[model samples]
Target: VMFFLFSLAFVQGVGSYLIQAGEDGSVTDDERDALLLWFGSVSTCMLTCFRVVTGGDDWGAYYDMLQPTGTINIIIFIFFVMFSEIALLNIVTGVFVENAMKLSQPELATLAFEQRKRDLADAASLRELFHQIDLDQSGKITAREWADIVETNEKLRYRLTVMGLDIK
Candidate 1:
């Protein structure tokens, strides 16, 4: 069931991306191919993680809900959220890169590193990053460490200047 569902999601993601491209404008074959490849890669990664995390417990119920009919609403909801998120990220990345471009290399790297401080708090892949910044570990980062991490850019100074890393 999981395998079939994962396959269906991969096909659906590619189909949606192409339809989206066509709705915006004409998409070249190269663009279509690129979208398929990218979607397939990401789908594979997500499916792997899902399978690992859902090997038991409520897996049957969750898997049962993933039928094409049942999951249609969820798929649309996810598509909108993911699309808007990507668009926002593009905007933010462009703005930040442009702002950082004028700074010296040292300052630019510092700013970029600081920009990633929020990501460091991620309990998944970034746990190691948070640990490195935590200094004393204790499963949390101190205010001074957070300040050090996000002090480069004036914008993020106040946001990350807390008692400890905001781990969830």
Candidate 2:
């Protein structure tokens, strides 16, 4: 199900770019330009597809491609919207709901607990993780050590819920 959505997004992204080629693809006064270069194609395609799917933004570039192409392209666009925007979105929603319904509340709690336990077991001990962060072997973590840890562990930077308590 995820693969289907990913494939659809890729196709739509390419379609969006191809259709909008006449317009400046660069960031201009009115529009934000894409950042970075190498992964831009796949990233922009996915972003454009996501925007179209969610109905957040549409510059009409994709539709504009139809202006010179005539009736056949219009038909193709209709199908693209139907399958990618409507059908795929609805199917993905249904799959999510179906999966949610498969597990009971108690079962979910048990699964969550088990997953947490497994993650903790697989990770380095809290003491060891902190020791690594304290590269100079100082008992206390300085600002540099803290910054180094946060930079290296992206997950920890995002998931720091406890202020006084430390966990790896």
The lDDT per prediction is 0.53, 0.55
Off by over 4 Å in 1: 1-69, 104-168
Candidate 2: give its CA RMSD in angstroms. Answer: 24.1
- Among all windows of 10 consecutive residues in model 1, the one with the lowest summed lDDT is 61-70
Candidate 2 has its poorest 10 consecutive residues by lDDT at 30-39
lDDT of 2 by residue, 113-153 (tens): 99899668545555666776788887889987888788788
Per-candidate TM-score against the hidden true structure = 0.21, 0.31
CA displacement after TM-score superposition, residue 85 of candidate 1 (Å): 1.4
Tens-digit lDDT string for candidate 1 (55-163):
4233333333322223563464345335545666798999999878855356776878876874565434345556667777688888888778766544434433452
Candidate that scores best on lDDT = 2
Please report the candidate that would top TM-score against the real structure.
2
